[model samples]
Target chain A: MAQRTVLFVLFDQVQSLDVTGPVEVFAGAERHTPGTYRIGTASLDGAPVRTSSGLTVVPDRSLADVPDPDTLVVPGGQGTRSPDPRLTDWLRAHGPHVRRLVSVCTGAALLAGAGLLDGRRATTHWAYCDRLAREYPAVDVDPDPIYVRDGHVATSAGVTSGIDLALALVEEDLGRDTALTIARHLVVFLRRPGNQAQFSAQLAAQTARREPLRELQRWITEHPGADLGVETLAARAGLSPRHFARAFRAETGTTPGRYVDRIRLEHARRLLEDTGDGVEQVSRASGYGTPEGMRRAFVKALGTSPAEYRRRFRPAPAH
Target chain B: MAQRTVLFVLFDQVQSLDVTGPVEVFAGAERHTPGTYRIGTASLDGAPVRTSSGLTVVPDRSLADVPDPDTLVVPGGQGTRSPDPRLTDWLRAHGPHVRRLVSVCTGAALLAGAGLLDGRRATTHWAYCDRLAREYPAVDVDPDPIYVRDGHVATSAGVTSGIDLALALVEEDLGRDTALTIARHLVVFLRRPGNQAQFSAQLAAQTARREPLRELQRWITEHPGADLGVETLAARAGLSPRHFARAFRAETGTTPGRYVDRIRLEHARRLLEDTGDGVEQVSRASGYGTPEGMRRAFVKALGTSPAEYRRRFRPAPAH
Candidate 1:
């Protein structure tokens, strides 16, 4: 049998990984299972589309010339931010022909725009779930899935989840060994499963909060470097320290102290990962009074020291 | 400071997610701190490069015309499989000028090909780690990292790891709040720093062994539908059941019965995830005689029932 072809459509400011991550899985699969899949790409017009980063991507086919695609993948970017009626029309027109219609991240918005998700259970990037639900009332949006598959329609959460969706499809088409090989190749578990909640339960607990406390949460987020305290935050929310503490637990699903610790820990992690800052500096910048404090947080939250965490998590610098 | 300019180099067979994932994180930052970043892409020859999925991407500039970028991101693809010497040369010549050099997935191989990984700690797509270590003696390859940053060189493991890397970078360049916003927009945690261990200590023990049982293990992996038992496996290994059980524990860090059950459960999981077979059918395919038995195993190992597991883990069908 001829290899099934998966065609990807790209555009200006499009999220690049939405396409590449899945492409990597498919490309890697050839090593394990010879000649099982073929992948390609295209654009709305024949012109090169600049990525959000100003990288121009030329399409393999124009909208007018796309061949019969076994699977059609559409990735989201700033280009999809404002609904393009023509693009929506094109997707709607092509919706029934493709074996599967897949979108990554906010590409779900584009799918929604096309009316393909109007009456089906679907999900997009989580931040946009409310907007998607608001904009497309006909669609039943699932905010939790990494990717949702309803018959032939599939949509993935955020940028990276596309890889999970793709690997799962590969497993479906091939078999477990082949999929495991690809996962090993990618160095990821075979599939996280869309049903596995996208966000951690703890994170959701923190984010699911009501105001005053919500305002305080925003303040902590906005001022990650500040030495935050319960009293100060409580004052900002116009609640007493004890009342605020109780309210915070009720509203955010965690204590004020733990929430603050989480924010600070997250801040320190960002510095350790992206910057060349020493542990001391990162610690201070994340509201920790000392490197030791930050180290303790790392041990508590991640079960690794800050230095070891940096060694494992930091991206290698170009020589 | 003026907004940092980022140039993503595009090419034929480029992984779509590699380009788009980073693009989304970087672009999403503009929503919180607008006008902080400018991102673009270019091809070596400024011609349209076909992505692995046959999507042709038009680039922003030819290699000759691109601005000296603040950050240079090279994504992995089959194009990097046997890298172009010219491309490697271009990277080597320009690598020094860029503030940071980053690679997603197998794109690290290109950096290694360019000699950028010399004497530096690095990582790539896990599947290619052996080849990377074998081929680049100067590079200290760490396969366990989701992403690694040594000096200004950064490399990520596999597809979605790129998003994690990008988020880290954004947090460094911008701030934690901004990075978190982007992460929230994408609906992913700010960092999943401790997610690198692919197998447990028990699985690692199995991987360390090299004997006739190793081949048997491989065979078991290849044929999950088989019903070979301790007796059958012992006969194949030319041992008595008692001796084989002891040796299996000594060599593989697991009891034979437990190992077989684990393998069976793993196979059953894949079937449940990839196929439409009912729980009973999946159980049978994975050598389990009954659905009830499989459910108990599934729940024990994975914390989800087979039916629920399928609903959650099943791959997106090709639309």
Candidate 2:
């Protein structure tokens, strides 16, 4: 395969991690498979840019000096909050031409401002998701997955998720074995622990504003093994089941049953990862009456049997 | 409580993440609880140090300008392999006087060379652990844990373990709640992981150089659910039970029974983290006869029941 030129764009106040995590992963891959990646960093002008954490980065080349690179990575930080028009103007003009256009964290904001992500399903740091959606009505901002790849334009969530997205790109280019090797070298999961596909977005999406409902939500999360049927929860909350379900949906954006399912799955997944517990015990603890119930949930939601899921996602003992 | 001042020593060729990961965590904490931690970065002469990744970092002040900091942090990279004598000399003179002394990645090498870790238990990047032990026999290097706390001086493994160690310090100084809040803001785990105490060290420690034995080791790791009795394994290896047991111990340094236990525990933990499988199924799949058997192993090894372990280690549905 021919070498791919990967250029990282540097700006003032960029979060250093948004740059290093991916850079390090790709760099590790390059070390293992030399001539696969030719990585470089550039700024709008050939000057030093200070990271949000107060580290200053001196760029290798000017943005104008390098044109139409295979991959252009834009990292986000405070600088993206109020960016230079020249930078966005540059992105607006050159983004579509690049083979791969990527953004880390709030760098999505810059891309949206430049119309690169217009009508694209994208994601950013969870904290900034709502703002990105609100500000750029044309951009489909997903606040859930660690990263999103909409065609050739890809975006990732806060800080470390950049590492995840970068690994995905590497895996695409060099296959799973190469990506896995680099991840092991970095001591990070090739895929982070747990099912990112059925990520905890539903439960993290909303919390009831009412104090009693909020307390109930916490209770449900904390005690996944407890009887979480609508009637039992309704009695505890001093409301009729019908009334409780309505209030929960109105306040939290999901029905009580759905929320409970999400929590139980999360609980079971944690047990599998952290403990040497049996599937039956994990199922019971996660409120599944039978092991089969948990298996069905795992298959339906995550598209893998519980055992296979564990095998795939869990760290292969440090060796 | 008086605000503790944390000073990070920066040097040329330092890993940027080694510096930023901890800085971002502390910076997030400061954002939440103002006046709690005053964090700064400095170099021997406050010059702009270029990181191994080629990013330039300008230190906040000169090392001579800051004396007797409450906490001193030395981050590692390629730079630590051949450090300036002035930096090591400074650390040797000033390390003990600080309330807390910390090292990340290969930074421990510098500390060990300076005699700061001469009689203290410590750790560094996993790949470097053996080298660190071989080079500095006086430094009681324990390579198992992600991070080690030897009195007031703490050392951590690799790039990301620094984040884990930093969070531990924040938890010690502030509280679980404060540290947890910062972690959530940064999209990282507060405690990071399931029984980090029962980390997969045994499996990581040795891989038999002999091809057949190495293949057997891989088999044991991959098929934790298999019947792995000495007789069964001996049959698979085409040897008598006694001979197989002896050869396995000699080659792997650990008995087959011990290796199997480690692999089983690791497999069970992965299921708990990634799947919605029930505990009984998880136990059976992990080759434990019953949920009770799995529970016993978990308690003996991780000191937590399966249900409790899942609760403690699982990510709270991400809100």
Candidate 3:
């Protein structure tokens, strides 16, 4: 088989992993299937490109000198916030010719700016998702998935999800067995399904706004065993339950029930990590009616069981 | 709280992700808890250190200028094969003062070469595990775990596992909740428990050596539905079942039964990825008599069920 050329575009201030993570996966794929992928990097002038972390990358070729690539990778970083028009023009000119076009993190912004992702479902770093959506209304930005692949263009959520996206590409080109092998070699999860949410309950909690709602949130967090139903929370907020639910959802972007559940789960997680309490006791203390109820909540929220969560997150005994 | 200083030792030819993955985790931790971890990079001369992938990182300070760090990170790549004496000397001089000493990939070689890992349980990248063990007999090298923590010293296997090690550090310093939040923001698995082996069934199959055993392995792979018992495999290899089992283990470092099981699981995984087969059909085709048996094997080997594996690895139909 002819070697598939994978050309990674290097630009000023690119996130180091946004380039390296996917590149490593492709390199691993080449190792698994010798002579399958010919990896290279290109820059505007073939000079060293400085990364966001003050790292500099030497590109293999200047954009003008490089041959058409089978796969074109554009990584995101602080650079993507204000991309050089030369780079965007290069992508606009060359992106459609590539068999596959991929963006890691805020690289989606560059692609969208280049008109490559217009009207396409895409994603970027969770923190930047709203900005991406607001900036590029033509692009359907879905922030949940680790990656979003629409047609031949793909976009990953953040830095490390680039590896997941590249693994999926390897799976498409080689096979699942090969992808799984590479994933194992990397010691990452075999595959993080693309649709998995990018934000955690804690992250959601951290985004709480409105003093009344924030105070209610803090109260709920501190008193997980308290009756945190909408009626009680609404009363605490000095509003009717219906009004509080709407106001909470509008301000927090989550329903009252979801907010309470997340708070309870966060409390339960802390109990699991800091204390040696068993599942039933912890569940009850966290306001879950039973161990089964808490287990369901854990699985629904974290895709892990209460026991597994505790096993994974529980603090090790100090020596 | 006094901010903990994490000094990442940048060297020529360092794998870019090996530095960025952990640095990002620490940076995320700082975001979660401001003034918690102060991250910086240092090089022997405090110059721009070129990484293995032709990326160069500008270090924050030289060894002479930087204060004693709470944590010191050494990353590895091509440069580790023959580390510069200047780097090793610096490590030897300063390593003991660091509260936590860490290595990613073959950076363990530098640690071991510096005599920092003498008589210590350590690990490196799987590909370099044997050499690490052979070269440093005093250092007990176990390559299975994603990251191995021995006292204040920690070493992670391969490049990406650096994030896992860093997350473990964050969990230890802050809490599991903080680590999980960082992991979620990064779009990586919440926590890959440290002990997870860095090899998959497909990786094992690819490592097969010796002609007769290789042929038998090929036959087993081709015929996953066939009875791949020791007796059948031995007949094919023209040896007694017991002798064949012993020789197989000697050559492959795994028992015949385990090898067959791995091959079957690999086949099952392929089916899950490629075909829209039900769990029962895939189970039967992969020589697992029942779906329950297949489920058990999948859970044991991959920590996921067939359905979940399919959901993760299966390609989405074209829109």
Candidate 4:
């Protein structure tokens, strides 16, 4: 019976999908159960703002003209790349006062700038995860899940994941059946759990600058199923293990073990997508000693099991 | 570069997501590969239109003022429930002239009204599939796919399926790698393959108005694996098999066999979602005879396999 008002903060160059995907979801919920949500959109000033996609949106009110709604949604975009300090200040002042605070994509950057996500588990667009972590040391950035809910604050990865998070919020507020009905009408999953690891734009390791290390990189990629311990890799590179480890990290921006893990993960993903091999076979071939090991790695880094990951990422039979 | 112009037709009470989702995808593609597309939105008179969720969108041009774009997109919402005759007339005049024509959600209704979809396989929002078929009997309505592409014309089901369709369109325009990059950035699937059957808003059967048949409905749901032939069910209902079959259709708005199929499918879906049973056991319990039969049903209706459907719809383990 409470918490009915939902407000979306709009801005210049905002990602249109981030704004509309979740807005339509809440609107659909309102249509399904009238009086469930009174939705509105606001911009920093009262003027119309052009979305990143070039669509112009006229807001219901300016942030200064509006009162804090029960739920506040902040959407991200290229605009977040150089956000106006006034906007982040506004978020800082009002974010904690709302019953629920949510961000989509690089909107988390704005939230992080406002310091509202301090000491909270959060996520942003996959490509920006490292930058978000580096820039905001107080926020724990988890890139796995499509969305993360830490107490009253929630942040969704990338753009469309906002729809998933909104559906969850509706499920919490109105109930699961209502959310499911809305999701069915929208033709999206009630949730994508986390995100697919196959689209790991952020995970590709940098090529080593040194020729020997670069050759080592190629060898590691070629033999993902081989023993990739530091000692083995160092011997293969003809360097002492300690020096090889530091040099690899310096050149690749990641440690030898982590680089090997990513190489094995990508190799196995390709096999799953391009081959008909079973999970067990793919695991052994990708250097995962057992299927359980692969499963754990998948769930830890991608919030999905290997089998489910293949099902989602593999092209749908060319139908 | 040969076909870069994409124009979206907008109207009052248009679903903002329908317009924005695809627009964002094309815009993302353009961002990734500059000069890829020149996109615009237009209404009949070039007036600003309010979205179904009350967001105001200012169109870039008027329909009459615009030239025939390479791609034409029509988005649907409450306004399509009683479309302006001029809009349909305009669509009828220009629909065939475009290099590619597309519709999202109930926008297919406008295309059908214009006779543009006549004799072509198309789909719309799931809830309106029956009405679309009944009203435009010439259009081959396939409800199974999230989006159906027939040559240069494409139609999508429901609201968010527009995003999936747009991703497909981008993939067709650019390369798979580019589309995948955009999809990763957006956090949406490159494709949802059609839709999830668990969200079968249109598949739910009408409750029989007759008490005898209503009782039969309950029985069928309670025991999906039971022998549900007309003779067996009729005998239990104290009526002759032939008479009961006729009465069932009149009361339930579907044939006995169809009703039983829905029951078994629903039962199987629930088992897949709620239980830990394997595919083989679930097939038998749902009266599917074999795992292959159940798989066939799932693929035909949901465009997903039983195992994949379970992964998609089940309540994911709490994070």
Q: Which is the leading candidate under lDDT?
A: 4
Per-residue accuracy of model 4 over B67-181 as CA lDDT, tens digit each = 9999899998999999999999999999999988999999999999999999899989888888999999999998777889997899988888887888888887887777877
2 or 3, greater by DockQ: 3
Query: Could you give me the TM-score of model 4 versus the true structure?
Result: 0.92
Determine the backbone clash count of candidate 2.
32
lDDT rank order: 4, 3, 2, 1
Using all chains and alpha carbons, the TM-scores for the candidates as numbered come to 0.62, 0.73, 0.77, 0.92
lDDT of 2 at A100: 95
Question: Tens-digit lDDT track for model 4 on A23-112?
Answer: 988999999988889999989897899999999999999999889999999999999999989999999999999999999988999999
Which is better, 1 or 2, measured by TM-score?
2
Instruction: Give the poorly placed runs of model 3, Cα more than 4 Å off.
Output: A1-5, A10-13, A34-50, A58-69, A82-98, A113-116, A193-195, A202-319, B1-5, B9-13, B30-70, B82-97, B174-178, B202-319
How high is the DockQ of candidate 3? 0.36
Compose the digit string of candidate 3's lDDT tens values, residues A234-297.
9989999999988888888888788778778878877887899988899999999899999888
- lDDT, residue A307, model 3: 78
The alpha-carbon deviation from the true structure for residue B151 of candidate 4, after best TM-score superposition, in angstroms, is 2.4
Lowest lDDT 10-mer window, candidate 4 chain A?
A196-205
| TM-score, structure 3 vs. true | 0.77
* Prediction-by-prediction clash tally: 66, 32, 2, 2
Interface RMSD per candidate: 6.6, 8.6, 3.6, 2.4
Q: List the residue pairs that clash in candidate 4.
A: A146-A194, B146-B194
lDDT of 1 by residue, A214-277 (tens): 7678889778778578888878888899998888888877888888887887777667767899
Best prediction by TM-score: 4
lDDT, candidates in the order shown: 0.75, 0.81, 0.81, 0.86
Better of 2 and 4 by DockQ: 4
